[model samples]
Target: MHATHSSGKGRGHGGGRGFRGAGGWQQADLPPADDAAAWLTGRLPDDWFVGAPTITVDREEIVIIGELAAPEGSDDNSAAAAAQGRIGRFREETREARMQIADEAEARYGRKVAWGASIGETKAIFTHLAVPAMTRLRHDERRVLDTLVDAGVARSRSDALAWCVRLVGEHTDEWLTGLREAMAEVDKLRAEGPDL
Candidate 1:
């Protein structure tokens, strides 16, 4: 069954956690948005999506991807094209309203908001942020990235590293999910403990 809102559930691991890193480029403190999915579900209009959207939150942005109702009597061959057209129409139609919602969400959550729509096998994101992160790697790790770059698998070391990370993420999604759940539990326990 489709739900209008997902109560008490969201994939917001490091986004809401207070920032305590000592690096100059590290982000400032952020408001906890464990309920970001729920909040967005409730805040969005009812007719916007066929059901509840899948929301993903990180330290920099919140992305909401909702499934749009399929076009009636669309054949298999035309379905993808129809879906793409619908997505474009939806984007143009919802520009103003989406901006307003994004503004409100950004103010409330201290992170940028991005929206997307999906239909059948087609999916589209309206906007998203690509926040740069600084990292140092050992010789072995740098060699791995360099190998990918040398092989033309990536244009640069950064792209190679990103490709590697994406590969790892796709392969270990189940393990990552479990880890996130465990971390959420730890966060809950920490919140219940005495204030420092």
Candidate 2:
């Protein structure tokens, strides 16, 4: 469920707004200055802004980067955000400033003036998971689990696995049965790990 735009033919993925090309830095085609305020009058996408609450007028372009109103019918709460977006197609001051910045940056970094880079793919962004809700033990298993929790051995599924890896398996008459039972318990711990 993400909006995608091909910024360039070669740039097929990445950038929150369907930007796909390597060279095509898509900017919203703004209307005249008078209508500029009206441009953002209606509902805008939730994540369109790269900056917010301040609009800067440059020599060449109007650089307005900020969070916008979330579109209607959105399931999530679309309050104002500190997101950003930039408009420079019609202004000159912004262009010069950007060029100057790029020149300085390139000189500093010793690289090409590759100014507009398509944002990284949103889907590829890594995320952290909650660890507490992963494993659920039965009533009888709960007593033992509480002890492990107290010992800080299994705060998450990964923690549980680490604990199991260090386990001294019980010695029983049927070695295979004991190993099988231990493995079964490990499986449950893995599926319900807190970091899911």
| TM-score to true structure, per model | 0.84, 0.18
- Each prediction's whole-model lDDT (CA): 0.82, 0.37
Worst 10 residues of 1 by lDDT: 1-10
Top TM-score hit: 1
Model 1 misses residue 24 by how many Å? 14
Candidate 1, 10-67: lDDT as tens digits: 2233345433321111333677778898999999999999988899987789999999
Which residue ranges in model 1 land beyond 4 Å of their true spot? 1-28
List ranges where model 2 is wrong by over 4 Å.
1-49, 52-93, 116-196
Residue 62 in model 1: lDDT: 94
The lDDT of model 2 is 0.37
Using lDDT as the measure, the top candidate is 1
**Per-residue C-alpha lDDT of model 2 across residues 1-196, encoded as one tens digit per residue:** 0123345342334444443222123322322232332333232233444433233221123333333333334333331111111122212324565456445433433333322211212111111222332454678766665667778878954566446534634334367456556755664675467652
